[model samples]
Target: MGFTDDGDIAAYRRRRSVEFKHGRIAMLATMGFMTPEIIGHWPGYLSPSMGLKFADVPNGLAALNVVPSLGWTQIVIYFGLIEYSGGFEDYRSGTPGDYAWKALTSDDPEDKRRRLNVDLANGRLAMVAIMAILFQNGVAGTTGPEMWIPAL
Candidate 1:
């Protein structure tokens, strides 16, 4: 954004696009991290060839070390692919985060603007919430609803 003094439309669009992407990821991650604490992880192994069992994975960030090396590579490649799919040309000239997906996005201008605002706000909140959740899970050893009720 400092590249330009004002009217930096490209930077603005790119920033919004990034914010939405991070917001969505954070929302999903928070749910994934907390849901297991409440209802437990998947019933069985997620990767049979690697003998990786989601159900056996520990809660919170500690689970990161349990993933196989190939899984981490796959994750990195997947993210890279998604990022490449949204070419830089689109960010510079066209809609920044508009994947033009048929569902979830709105056609109305007002609704689109509102959704963008809320996405940024929620993303910022989720960024902080995730850190707090991680600290609590890793340090206090509490999760989900149990963190609130001492008797639980």
Candidate 2:
């Protein structure tokens, strides 16, 4: 939309806003995928408190079966609360991912732009990496998103 039209920087920004949101989500998902493998087992209420030990859990798609219903419910509720509190106005307005943490923000515009570019690049790479991992697991006869597609 922006490429064909001159002086369409706003349109480009609106598209980039969607990219930024996806990038953030992919980054979070990438961390979640790796966290269990890195830590063996979470020390928090997600694992120990649920009577789940490090050995009891499996990595990749198999881990999804190990988690209890309550764990998923708690996660949904927690994130739901955050979403409800913040509302979707930021995303709707094409300015997403601002948690209002001033400490994490930079006073310099150039610095902020640089950091955002880095974040966007990293997130894009993470999205591709995670998708590749999922696809690899799917092809290996593992349980994952591929099961939902009959063609796969």
Candidate 3:
């Protein structure tokens, strides 16, 4: 059966709810604590305070490791690419919680797809930059993506 107007509305609502849930999950993940098991560890009133102590681990430790290995020229290029990719990842992941802050943030499915495409492109570029820098600095050999897959 074809979807009626009500069905479409319901689907839209469901999709929006999923997106908001993802946003919340991202926030919680970034917070470092509040995993289901840990939620009960803190007292009800002091949960926020307790969570703050356990949570708050910084993201992008891999990116941080890339820094010391890059040489002078590679450092500049790698860092620039990393920064760009990081921004793209944040956009695609929607973990920064800035969706409403942007003027043209769209809930359209097509727009979301476009954002994902950008995210993928940026991610690939970032990886390439990292590998090139690493290869130049003798951190990685010339085995290409295959070399990293096994390690992952």
Candidate 4:
């Protein structure tokens, strides 16, 4: 039996497409808010013992410093992977989730399973790396509860 024969490929694609679009929108919105959020707190209010101070660095350098120090590079890397993995093409074609869904529903079940496994593994790795950075910066500790409370 073929892979497409096991299920409705079109329906699966449509459902996956909607999910992908929603996830992309949510991710982009979060990143938009998180960049400034981190910039406001990092190195200024939440600098670790040896962390660079925003005030000590020039404006240009400080802006550059936040990119790597605040885990923004991970966001960059995620988007980069999306683009490289054909997600960008799917988006450009107005089918936001086709790339991944196609891979998951491809004719070769073994290949599909392998791709999904790798994607899952990579996602976990990224999460671990981000958590490690947060811990390294002391953001994971209970010492700064007040710093996390958003001001209205």
The numbered model that scores best in TM-score is 1
Q: What is the TM-score of each candidate against the true structure?
A: 0.78, 0.65, 0.25, 0.29
lDDT of 4 by residue, 1-152 (tens): 35456597565555555555455454444444345444643447334565656544332223455544545667688877866784344434543343646744455767765665555454445555544534544543321223568767
* Winning candidate number (lDDT): 1
lDDT of 3 at 93: 45
lDDT by residue (56-127, candidate 3, tens digit) is: 321223224332332336758986796567443333444322344233344775776566445444444554
Model 1 sits at a Cα RMSD from the real structure of 2.9
Relative to the true structure, candidate 3 reaches a TM of 0.25
**Rank list by lDDT:** 1, 2, 4, 3
Model 4 residue 38 lDDT?
Answer: 48
TM-score of 1: 0.78
- Off by more than 4 A, model 3: 1-105, 139-152
Global lDDT of model 2: 0.67
Question: Each candidate: what lDDT?
Answer: 0.74, 0.67, 0.43, 0.50
The number of residue pairs in model 1 that clash at the backbone is 0
> Pairs clashing in candidate 2?
none
Candidate 2 vs candidate 4: the lDDT winner is 2
Candidate 4: list runs displaced more than 4 Å.
1-7, 40-152
